[model samples]
Target chain A: MDIIVSQLMTGLSIASILMLVALGLAVIYGVTGVINLAHGEFVMLGAYAAWALQTEFGMGLLASLVPIFIIMAAVGWLVEVLVISRLYDRLLDTILATWGIGVMAQQAVRLAAGGELRYVQMPEPLSKSVTILGATDSAYRLFILFVALALFAVTWVIYRHTNFGLKLRAITQNRAVASSYGINASRIYRLTFAYGAGLAGLAGALVSPLKSVSPEMGTNYVVDAFMVVVLGGTQSLMGTLASSGILGELSGYLAFYSNDTIAKALVLLAIVVLIRFRPQGLFTARVRT
Target chain B: MSGKTKTEIVICAAVCLAILLVPVFMNDSFLLNKYARYLVLGMLAIALSLSWGYAGILNLGQATTFGLGSYCMAMALKLKTIPIHTGPDGLPDFMVWNNVPELPWFWKPFYSTTFGVTAGIVIPLLFAALLGWFMFRGRVTGVYAAITTLAAMVVVQLVIIDQQAYTGGFNGITDLAQFDVAGFAFDAYGSASYYLVAICLTASLFLALAVTKSKAGLIVQAIRDQEDRVRFFGYDVALYKIFIFSVSGAIAGLAGMLYTIVMEFASPTFMGVPLSLSVVIWVAVGGRQSLVGAMLGALIVAGMQGALSESETFLDSWTLVMGLLFVLVVLFLPKGIAGAVETITARFERRDPAPAQQPQRTDAAGAGTHHLESLP
Candidate 1:
């Protein structure tokens, strides 16, 4: 019972992180027809932001979130203005352009930070393993779970009930009509991109303690986030949530049964197989074209 | 053929010949060897262009085919170097270190040079054909193809790194014997290796050119321009996709084979995302529509990389420059360097202008004149 509970905790923790990282990708992809290949770099930039704050200002990871989120969001806004703004209509070209931006971000980080791992000090209160539901796990892991749930709730409310959410969804369905309705689609796109970047930044800041922060760290996470987005049916919020849960738990369970590497390989293989069969993914978004 | 395109063809042939004759002017074996590596990589770029530029398929995991091809040759070369003292049935060094008792049965076929060489090319085709079948049958076209291929790359790389005993794990299969063909030795330091690589690259370029210029090539281009329209015309889009993908994979594998000969080892890095993405960068920068341009792009990019990494000041910023170039090309020069050249030449010299969009249907397969018009 202890092992099963611990496994479930592990699964949920990973699922939460995946959800946090993937949420930004889902949001940006949903609002803007452009697929941001630089989404991973935003996550990386966020982690670096947290690291910079922790090391330079002696700030804790928990304290660094708001500032990091703002800064990364600003970066995202600038990126949209400078690069993504021009390439909105060209989907394939956006991939190439954003990918170029991603590479530039990676190289820029490496040039500034050097090719070495940088660690963030885990907070004193959450440093130790604690018992939850009669099973022991890191206290930090539980905090992340809380953050993920809180984030989901926050995002769900912002998009579902808010006027801004309505504007964003309206533009996504029909840009001209939304503009006809007097919605500033471009302005909304900038905010959506920035908010997505901020969310990614928060995911990075939260995740810094779990692993040593590095430039290349975002690459794997971004790919996983992309998988979530692709498998989640690009425009569906609920799909991202459910797919993240399934993929995370499946890999976590598989790891318990066998090795982590094999678990990862099998998960990828399964996703590929699933993608082959269901190209549109699990749930299709209803957009009025 | 227009006088300008004929000049472009002449320029391409001259560049290849000049690279082939590089040893005469340059005494540096290091320079010669580096050029050889560029040509090998250029072969890969050509292979990528055939599918990506012509068929409108962006196979983001091209390194998978390249790596598989290299590994096949590496296994054979590693087998040849296995000492008799380890016994006739003894495994490679890494396998022994990993406590693998004997040679794995699958590797036994790689013991023969003929079989190993054949398998090196054939396996990648089969792998690509199977992947293409799955992708095309599922209608995983456009960006979905890119996503699936990238995922496939990660999976393949992880598998290679995971199975230590079978694949030599992280370090990969190394210290390969010099590549030989029917007792003709290819010493890394010798002139023969360079010629062999150049010959293969030139042949592959022409072969791809032949393919793109054929009636089949027109059909593939039409499919790229309009998939459903061609499907409506009763062509099996899936079969053509698979065929082109397989051919591209075969050429990539052959390039990998040559790469092993020049580089002297094959590692999991060959199949990693960065190298695979690098192939896309090379093809895109050279103008994907032009085979010769793709080749030159690889050559130029590889050359710049070598120079930049060596210089102390530019070392850190070189990749940044590459990234910047990638973005700039996509935005400002979508047609790439070749497109620039074509336009520049067009302004200076006017001729019987070919249709601005698609080339006219040409029945002649080997007409060098037809080659220039069809390429852009």
Candidate 2:
């Protein structure tokens, strides 16, 4: 029972990070209908921002979160306006273009940061270990889990009850009809894209202390977040939350039995199998195509 | 033959001749070895073109097949080198280091040269067939196929990295012997290896061109243009996709085997994400629709990479330039360098239009229009 509790705690922490990353991807893909392969770069940029803020300005991770979010949001806005806006309906071209954008972002970071691994310092207070119900984990991990829940709650409220989300959903359902209804679909897309990017930035900033910061770190995050979004229905926010939890738990449990690399492989294989059977994903929402 | 096909054959012959004459003009063994590696990469570009261009299947995990072929060849070469490196145990050095007591059953078959050569192509072909079967049968198209294949490739990379005893972990298979047939040896720096790659590339290029021009090739193109419409015409769309995918896999495997001969070793990075994406970039830059153009794109881009890396500043900025080029190509030069050549040629031939090719332009434009609506 204690082991289960401890594993559950570990799973929750992993799920929280997955949730944060997938939230932005799910939002952008749901509204814009383009899978932003460069979304990973956005996360990487966020982590880099955190590292820079800490090293140069001596800012704590918590204090730099808002600034990193804004920075990444602006970056996302620029991407949407410059490249994604033009390739809106061209799905394959969008994938290629975004991948190019990702490569450029990675290479640019490598050049700027000199391709060496940079570490972020953990907040002193949150660095200690905490025991709850016979399960001990870093306080910083619990902090991450709490922040993820808070973000999800905020996302859920925005999506469910806000006017901006209504417009976004309306456009998602039928772009022509939404435009006819006087909704500025393009502007909504721009904002949503920015917001999603901001979420990914926050996730990256939070994760910087845990994982070593590098140009290629974003690739793994992007792949993991993609699996989460893919497994969770693409357009479903709640589905993203649920799928992350399931995947994180599965990964933690499998890694407990075997090793990290094999666990990852198995999770990917499982997702592929699931996609083979149900391409609509595990928790598909009823939306008009 | 049609005027277009005649032009293609002439171009292929010219390119092949130029490749064959590289060692003659550049006597430096180092340069010859590098050119040989580029030739293998050119073959990789052609393999990508077979599927991505003609079949409209953007296989993001193409390196999986290529890497599989490389490993198969590497394993065979490793066995031959084992007698010299390790004791009478006959195990790979890495295996012995990992405390593996006996030779794994899977490694035993690779000892025979015939099996190694055949397995290099067949294993990747079978793997691709299985993957293609699942994906196509499920009607997974466009980006879903790309993501699935990408995930599958990562899984393979992780597995290869994790199984340190069976497969070399991270460092990859090294210290391979020269690939030889009976008494004849194909040295990396020798004219024989360069000629071998040149011939293989030329043969594969012509064979690919022939496939693209055949009736089934036409049907494949039609499927790319309008998949559902072709299905309504009573064609098994999935079967065709699987066939082309597997064939592309086989070609990639052949290239991988050739890569081992030229590069002298195989590593996990051979099939990593970046190399796989680079293959796509080569096809995109060369002209996905043109086989010769894709091959040249690989050769040119790879050659430029080798040249540019000599300067420290250029090394840092090369990926940025390529990335920018890729983005710009996707936006404006959708047909790439080959497309530009076709455009110039078309203008010249406009005064005397070929009746046979009147609808080609319209067909491509129509396909573009269809693609926007069909993909979600």
Top-DockQ candidate index: 2
TM-score of each: 0.93, 0.95
Can you write out model 1's per-residue Cα lDDT over B101-151, one digit (the tens) per residue? 888889999989888789989999999999999999877888888888888
Candidate 2 runs further than 4 Å off: A285-289, B351-376
lDDT of 1 at A37: 84
lDDT of 2 by residue, B1-376 (tens): 8988998999999989988988877888888899899999999999999999999999999999999999999998888886875545888888889999999999999889889999999999999999999999989988889888998999999999999888888989888888999979999999899999999999989889998999888899989988999999999999999988998999999999999999998999999999999999999999999999999999999999998999989987998999999999988887789988987776566535655666677568657865885663
lDDT for B95 (candidate 2): 88
Per-residue lDDT value at A59 in model 2: 95
Query: lDDT by residue for model 2 over A1-289, one digit each (tens)?
Result: 7899999988898999998899999999878878888888899999999999999999998899999999999999998898888888677888889999999999999999989999999999999999989888899999999999899999889888999878888998889999999999989999998999999889889999999989988888888998998899887888899999998999989999999999999999988887788777889956323
Q: At residue B107, what lDDT does model 1 achieve?
A: 92
Q: What share of the true interface contacts does candidate 2 keep?
A: 0.80
**Could you tell me which residue pairs clash in candidate 2?**
none
Docking class of 1: medium
